[model samples]
Every structure is written in structure tokens, then in C-alpha cells.
Target: MQQPVRIAPSILSADFANLGAEVRAVDAAGADYIHIDVMDGHFVPNLTIGPMVVQALRPHSAKVFDVHLMISPVDNFVTAFAKAGADIITVHPEAGAHTHRTLQLIRSLGKKAGVALNPATPVSVLDYIMDDVDMILVMSVNPGFGGQSFINSQKDKIRAIRQRIDAVTAGTSRVIDLEVDGGINAEMAPVAISAGADVLVAGTATFQGGPEAYADNIRRLRGPLV
Candidate 1:
């Protein structure tokens, strides 16, 4: 059976003072996963939360902790984040020298391994590692910051990755999830979903409004059920 699309609210856009409450609110608001963007100043141009923050929010979240690591030398920190409670750990393909090893490390640590492709990165980078990962994160906007406009060009990228995943895992029950991050809102989400995305990562779109609005926003983004 085809699974329903999942909405992951990025905590980067949440109020830090009451992060726990914000996380719980979004979970209650119907977020399938709590998306955390972990950025190191060197990797992306900004610095954001680290494993400690994820550990703190872990107790408040009953949903999956989808952690996206936008930091350089990601290999050194995979275990730390996993121990801190990341259910799904994603690392950018461009962040390290050994991408496959990093994905394996995340898996070895007992978390779902994911690979992310930057806006400018091609879909072919995932070819060799496709079978090993649980999800592929396509950045529709540049990383580091939230609320940026969606790069509509990524629609084709998402479809291409989805096709590749489908081709490789044809006879197996194992399925690779196609996830789109950046600039996802109620209006843009349907476009991504129609293009074959199984997971939608929304930051500003969820936090721009209050909790109730955030929950309503997720429903609106999902659109009418087929």
C-alpha cells in the first residue's frame, strides 16, 4: 500500500525559549516527525542547534526525530546525535569525504540513515547509495536558513530520485522515501507531493502561525484525500 505523505515541522523556525512546548505543540498539531536542522558555521554559513538541543527536545516529542545534519565532517558526530536521540539521521552528500560511510555509520548506530542533496546537487549522487538509505532529502532551497522561497526546479529532481528509487527497489519491500525540504507551505506542498515526494519538511510555514494554525496548515498542505 502507498503510504500517506508525512509533514515534518523544522524546529529551526520554532521559538527557542519554549522549544519543548513548541515541539509538543507541533506533534499535537499533527506533525509526523519533528525536523531538526543541525548546522555548523563552517558547513553552511550559519550555526544552529546541536545534539544537546535534540536531547532536550526528545522528551517532549513522541514522534520521529528527523535530524538533518548540515555540518562538515559529519562522521565525527553521527554517534553523538544518535545517542542524543535522533530516530532518523540525515547528512548532506556534500558534507563529507566519505558519504557512504557516513550513511552506514548512522545505520550502525541504530538510526534510519538518510542522504540529502543540495539545491544545486544532481540526483545522480545518490545512485550508489540508494539501496542503503531509508530516505533522500532534496533541498528545494539552500540550507542554513529557513523561510526561503522554494526552488521550483527541484520538482523534476524529486521525480527523478523517486524514479531511481523505484527502479532499484522494484522487487523488495524496502522503499526509499523521497523527502523535500525548504520553502514548503500549503500551496507548494501539493506540487511536491504530486511530483512523488513522500515527506515534506516545512519550517517557517509551520511556525509562522500559532499551534492551531500549524496543525491546520499541515492538513491544508496535504490537500483533499484521494
Candidate 2:
């Protein structure tokens, strides 16, 4: 069965000048999770916030802190992010020397572990770590920058991962969320959901028009099918 649609407003597009207020507003506006994009210039093309920002924003919202770490040597910072109050820590396979060990380390810290797949990354990588992952983030756009266009080719990747997750968790109680990030707006959200994305990470779509329009943006992203 398909999971209920969840809206995770990305803080990357939030008003950085008043991030705490932005987080709080989105939380109150029906955001299911607070998505934080942590990037290192080495792993990704751009450099973004670090664990300190996450810790600072921790008190702003009580919702699940879905932290996506786009950094190399990800193992070194797992403990930091977990201690910083990240409910879910997502890392890319290319960022670590051993993705399996990385996931184990995250789960050991009592944080839900997830694997993020870049636009060009292959789904075969998940074959070894599917059971260990709590979520699978498919980057619909190239990672690093925000407000980029969605890569239509990724819909096929999303569908493949969804089928793999379903097969692995067929009859058990395992719940692995299929998340789609990048280029997600009200218009493109439904296409990703149709391809089996349960969690929608929208930066521009959710934070645009300020706080007043957040609720409506989320409702539109959730769509009538939801």
C-alpha cells in the first residue's frame, strides 16, 4: 500500500535571517518534518549549514528533523548530528567509504538512518542497505543548489526504489519512506507522488510567499490524491 503523503519543508529556502521563526511557522503550517540540507563544498558544489545550525534550530520545532548530510566522510559527523537532535539522518552512498557501516552507526545512535540517491546514482547501491535504511531520498535535481528544475528521468529511479522497498518490506512492519527532493513545487509534486514518493521535500514551494501561504502550498503539494 502507498504511504500517506508527508510534506517536509526544506529550511534551505526559509528566511535565513529569521530561520527559527520560519521553522516555527512552517511547523504550525502543517509541516510533517523539518528538512535541513547540510552540504560540504567538497561533496557537493555548494557549502551550506553545519551541525551547529541544526542544534540552533532544534528548539524551534518539535517535528522530526530530517537532516540530509551531503558531506564526505559522513561517519565522522553522525554522532554530532545525532547529538544535535536530528531525528532522521540521511547520507549519500558516495559520501562515505562504506555506506553499510555508516547506516549502522546512525541506527546505533538511535536516529533513523536514510540513504540519499543522487540523480545519476544507481538503485543497485540500495540492494545491500535497503533493510538498514528508514528512508530513501531521490534527488530529482542535481544536489547542491536550490530552485533547480526536476530531472524527469528520476521518476524511473523513484519507481525502481519503491518497488525494491516494497519487496523488502512486503509483509513485515518495516516502514521505509520514499522521499523526493529538489525541484519540488505544487505543480511537480504530484508527478513524484505518482512515481511512489511518500515524503515531499519542497524548499521554494513550501517557503514561497512567506508564512501566510505555507498551508495552502502544502495542501496543494499533498494534492487531491492524498
Candidate 3:
């Protein structure tokens, strides 16, 4: 069954100086998950928030903190993020040498483990470790920065992963969320949804009109179905 589309407004584009208030605003505006992008300069060319910031933002809302770690040797930091209140921690396959071990660590921490697939990375990466994952993030643009144009090619990847997720769910009770990040706005949102993406990570689109327009932005991203 196709799940209803969910909007996860990325905090990368939120006001840096007032992250707490921004988180509160989005939560009040009806955001499903608080998407937090963590970047390391070595892995993604830009550096963003860390565990402390995540901890700070934790008190602002009761929403799930969907933390995406764009850092290499990712296993070393999974515990910290999980401790800091990340309900879902997403790691890229390229970030660590032992993807399966890394995922196991995240799960062991009592938090949901997610795998993020970059544009060049193949969907087959999930073949061996699908059972260990709770969510699959299909990046529609490169991971380093935000506000990039949507890469239309990724829709194919979304469909492929969607089929794979369905195959897994058919037998077991595993329900993996197919989330699409990068360049997610009102325009490309429906395109991703048609390809079977249930969750969207919107950065600039969610923060463009400031806190007041957050509800409308998220509604637009979710389309008429909501």
C-alpha cells in the first residue's frame, strides 16, 4: 500500500541564529519530522550542526529529529547523535567502510537506522543490508549544500527502491520509509510522490517565506492529498 506523503522540513535552511524558534515554528506549522542535516567539511564540502545543536533543538519540539549525518567514519558518531535525541539517524554508504556494521550500531543504540543513497550510488547497496535499515533516503541532489535543482534522474532510483521496500514488506512486518531529500519543493514534490516517495526533505522551500509561511509551504509540498 502507498503511504500518505509526509513533509519533513529541513532545518538547514532555517534561521541559524534562532534554530530553537524555527523548530518550534515548523512544529506548530505541522511538520511531521524535523529534518536535520549534519555535514562534515571532509565528506560533503560543508560543515553544519552537530550533536549539541541537536540537543539544543530537542527541547523546542516533540517531533522526530530526522538526523542525516554526511560524515565519513560515520560509525564513530552514531552513538552521540542517538544520545542527543535523534529518533532517526541516516548515514550514507560512502561515509563508512563497513556499512552493515555502522547500521547495526545505529540500531543497537535504540534509534531508527536509515541509509542515504547519493545520486551516483546504486540502489543495490541496500541488497545485503535491507533488513538492517528502517528508512531509505534517496537524495535528489548532491548532499553538500541546499537549494540545488532537483535531479530528475533520481525518480528512477526511487521507483526501484520502492519496489524493493515493497518486496521486503510483503513478507515481514518491516515498514521502511522511502524518503527523498534535496531540491524538494512544490514543483518537484509531486514528481517524487508519483515515484513512490513518502517523505520529503525540503530546505529552502520550507524556510523561504519565513516562519509564517511554513504551514503553506509544507501543505504545498504534500500537495492536495493532505
Candidate 4:
């Protein structure tokens, strides 16, 4: 049987002042993973959380920390995120020249390695590194900020990457997760799912009305999958 789709709620849209409480509330509401977007102003015109925030929030929930690094010079922060309790660390290949090394570093720290591809980026970049990664993040919108509209053209890209991942790990024990993020709400979710995305990341949709809304929002985004 195929694995059930996973919902990873992004904390970028959560209340920062009450992050620990927010995380706990989401976890209680059945979030599969906690998606954390770490941005550097130089990389995507925004600056957000760092290792300290992650470390402090680590004790609040048992859900996986899906740390997305939208920072250039990505290598310097790999260890910090890993040490901060990120279960899976995803990096944009465009942010650093040595993506292979970055993947290796993440794995060295005993964490799942992931690569995020922007809407304009070709899926070909993942060819050689397919076997090296644990997940492939398909950005449905540009990376810089949250709440952007979904780039509908990415449906084909998600399908192509899923095929590549399956082909590369055909004979191995490896299983790669195909994740879709940005502007993901109840409506756009099925688009990605139909195109073979297994993990959906939602920010504004997930935390919009506070913790009580999380379960309903997640249920809606999940559609019949619940």
C-alpha cells in the first residue's frame, strides 16, 4: 500500500511570541511534522529564525522539524540546525555551490537530507543526487516569502521528480518523500497530490485561526485523506 500523505505545518505563519505553545498545540492537533523556514535576508529578501529558536522549541513537541534553509553560504548553518534538533534539513541547491557536501554534512549528523527546488528550477538538478537525498521539496511558489500564490505549472515538475526518485531508488532500500510547499491550502493540495506529492507544507492555511483551527484546517487541506 502507498503511504498516507503527511501534513507538515509551517511555523513561519505561527505566532512567534507563543511559538512553544503553538508547537505543542499543533502537535496535539495531529501535525505530522513542524516545518520551519529559516531565511537570510541576502538569500530571499527575508530573515527569520535561527538555531536558538529551534533549540528552545525542541522540547515542546516530538514532531519532526523540517528545517528549510533559504540562506546563502548554507554550509555554515548545517551543523547548527542539526544540533538544534531538526529531523530533516532541506537546502536550496541555488544557495550553495557545494550541494553534495551539504547533503553529506546533513547525513553525517544523522539527519534526513532534503533539497528544495524553486518553481523555475529544472528537475534535472536532482538526477545525480536522487539517491543521496531523503526528500525532494517542490516549491509551488518562489522561496522568499510565505502566502504567495501557487505556481500551477509546478505540477508537471513534481511528477517528473517523483518519477526520477522512483527510478533512482528502484533496487535500493531508499524511499524519498516528494514534498510540496507554498500557498498550500485545502484547494491547492489535491493538485500536488494528484501530481504525486506525498508531503504537503502549509503555513497560513494551518495556523490562521490559532490552535483550534489547526485540526479543521489540516482536515480540510487533507481532504478525504483524513
Candidate 5:
């Protein structure tokens, strides 16, 4: 059976002061996962949340905590986030010297592992680790900040990666979620979906009008993919 499309609201653009309430609001608004972007300034020129914050927000919602680490030296922080209640941990392959080891560490900690490819990073890097992860995150825009424009060229790349994941996981019970982050909105939802993305990550588009608008925004973002 095909997996249902998911709308994950990125909290990078949410109100940080009331984070727990914000998380609950989004979960109530129908978010499949709560996407937390962890930046270390050194990796992408911006700094954001840590495990302490994640641990605090864990009880606010039972939705999947999709943690995307945009920090360098990714391996050093895997354990911390995993213990902080992150259900899914994703790291950029270029962020560490040993990508395979990082994935292993995440899985060893009992969390779903994922590898995120930047807009310029080719899918070939996943050749050996394709089956090692539970998800493939395609950055539709460069990581760092929220509300960036989507890279048009990534549509084909998304399709290519989806095809590759299918090929590698053939005849197995393994299911790799294909997620696209950055610049995702209702209008672009179908594009990403048709290109084979099952999860859509949006920040500004999701939290723009505050919690009250979340339901309609998420509804529009889900489009006809239900």
C-alpha cells in the first residue's frame, strides 16, 4: 500500500517563547510530524535549538519529532537528540566524516535514521547507504533559514531519489519516507507530491498567520494528496 502524504510544520518559524503551546497547536492542526531544524551556525550560517528544547517539547505532542540537524560534526550530537525524544533524526552526509556510522548510531539509539541531501548534493552519495536509512530528506532550498524559495530543479531530483529508494528497497518490508523541505506551500505541494515526495516540510508557510491559521494552511498544504 502507498503511504499517505504528510504535512510537517517546521517550528523554525513558530513562536519560540510559547514553544510547547505552539507544538500542541500544530499537532491539533493536523501536522504529521513536528520538524525541528537544528543549526550550529558553522554548518549553514545560522543557529537554532538544542536537545534541551526538544526534551521540553516532547510531552506537548505525540507527533513524530522529525529532527533535521544542519550542524557540522553531526555524529557528536546524535545521542543527545535521540535521548531528547527525537523520533526521526536526519543529518547531511557532508556534515560528517562517517555518514554510515552516524546512521548506525541513530538506529542503535532506536530512532529512525535519515540522510538529507542539499539542493546541490547529488543522490549518488546515498548509493551505499540507501537501505540504511528510514527516510530521505531532499532540501528544496539551502539549509540555514526558513521561508526561502524552492529550487525548481529539485523536482527531477526528488523523482530520481524516490526511484532509487524504491529500487533499493524492493521486495522488502522497508519503507523510506521521501521528504522535501524548504519553501513548501499549498501551491507547491502538488509539485512535490507528483515528483514522489510523501512528506512536505514548511515553515513560514505553516506558521505565518499564527496558530489560528494552521488548520486552513495545513489543509491547503495537504491538497488532494489525502
Candidate 6:
């Protein structure tokens, strides 16, 4: 049987001063994981939080830390982030030269390894590493920024990746999670989920309002049929 979709609220849009409070709110709201976007100015255009932030928030969060590393030289930092309490470390396919090795490193650290694909990146890039990963992140919009419009072209990509994962994992105990990130709001959540995304990452949708409303938005996004 297929598992129900999980909602991971990205804290990139939260008020930095009240980060711990924000995590607590999501926890109370029943968030499955706390998505942290780690951006280095080189790999992506913008820079965001890193391992230090993850470490600081660890004590406050009982949920998983789904750390999306949008940085170059991700291999050098994967262990640091994992040590800082990242439950899952998702590295971008466009981030660096060593893709498979990076995933291996994440696994060596005893954390779930995930590979993220940009909108233009083909699912074929995952051909060799699919079996090694625990999750595949499909970007619905360009990285480096939040609140961007969802790229409609991503629907087909999501479906294609889903098919690939299913085909490869058939009759095996291993299950790879299809995760959709960027521009994931209540309106678009269902479409992404319907395309076989088991995890939905939302930033603006969850942090735009106060905790109660944000939590409600999460519930609404996870509404039946999505």
C-alpha cells in the first residue's frame, strides 16, 4: 500500500529570532519533518543557514531535520550537518562533481541520503544512485529563493521520476521516497502528491501566517485526495 503524503515545513521563511518557537509550533501542528534549506552563495545565487543553525534547532525539534544542501563542496559539509542533527541530507545533483560519493557519505554518517534535481535536470541523473538513496527531491521551481511560482513543467518530471523509482524498486524491500520542493502550496500540493510525491516541502505556505494558521495550512495541504 502507498503511504500517506508527509508535510515538511521549511523554516527559510520563518522569523529567525523565533526559530525555536517556529519549530515548536510546527511540532505542535504535527509536522513530520522540519525542512532546513542550506544555501551557499556559490552553488545557488542566495545564501541561507548552515550546520550551526541546524545544531541550535536540534534541541528544540523532536521531528526529523530534512536538510536540503544547496551548496557546492557538499561532501565536505555532509558529515558536519549530520553531526549537527540532520536526519536526512538532500544534496542537489547540480551542486558538485561527486554525486554518488556524496550520497555514500551521507549514508556513512547514519543519516538518510537524498538527491535533489533541479527543474531542468533529467531524472536519468539518478540512474546510478537511485538504489543508494532514501529520497529523491523534485524541484518544482528554481532554487535559491522562496515564494516563486510553481513551474507547471515539473508535473511531468515528478511523474517520470515516480515511474523510475517504482520500476527500479519493484519487488524489493527498499522504498525510495519522491519528494517535491519549491512553490508547494495548498493549491498545488494535491497535483504534486497525485504525481506520486510522498513528501511535500513548503516554506512560504507554512510560514506566511502565524503558527495556528500555518499549521492549518499544512492540514489543508494534506487534506484527503492529495
> What are the lDDT figures for the candidates, one per model?
0.89, 0.93, 0.93, 0.90, 0.93, 0.89
Which portions of model 4 show Cα errors greater than 4 Å?
none
Which lDDT value does model 2 have at 80? 97
Candidate 3: residue pairs that collide: none
Clashing pairs in 1: none
Instruction: Name the runs in model 3 displaced over 4 angstroms.
Output: none
Q: What is the lDDT of residue 214 in candidate 6?
A: 75
User: Over the stretch 34-147, how does candidate 5's per-residue lDDT look in tens digits?
Assistant: 999999999998999999999999999999999999998999899999999999999999999999999999999999999999999998898899868999999999999888
lDDT of 4 at 91: 95
Each model's total of backbone clashes: 0, 0, 0, 0, 0, 0
The C-alpha RMSD of each candidate to the native structure, in angstroms, is 1.1, 0.8, 0.8, 1.1, 0.9, 1.1
lDDT score for candidate 5 against the true structure: 0.93
* lDDT (Cα, 0-100) at 121 in candidate 5: 99
lDDT of 5 at 47: 96
Write one digit per residue (lDDT tens) for candidate 1, span 1-226.
2479998999899998889999999999889999999999999988999899889889997899999999988898999999999999999887899998888888888999999999899887976887689999999998889889999899999989878888877888987888999889888998998888989999888887777688777788777752
Off by over 4 Å in 2: none
The deviation in Å at residue 82 for candidate 2 is 0.4
Runs with alpha carbons beyond 4 Å of true place in candidate 5 = none
How well is each residue in 1-226 modelled by candidate 6, as lDDT tens digits?
A: 3479999999998888999999999888888989999999988889988789899999997899999999887888988999999999999877768898889889988999999999999878987887789999998998999999899999999999888988888887887889999889989999998888999999899887788687688888897854
Q: Model 6, poorest ten-residue lDDT window?
A: 217-226
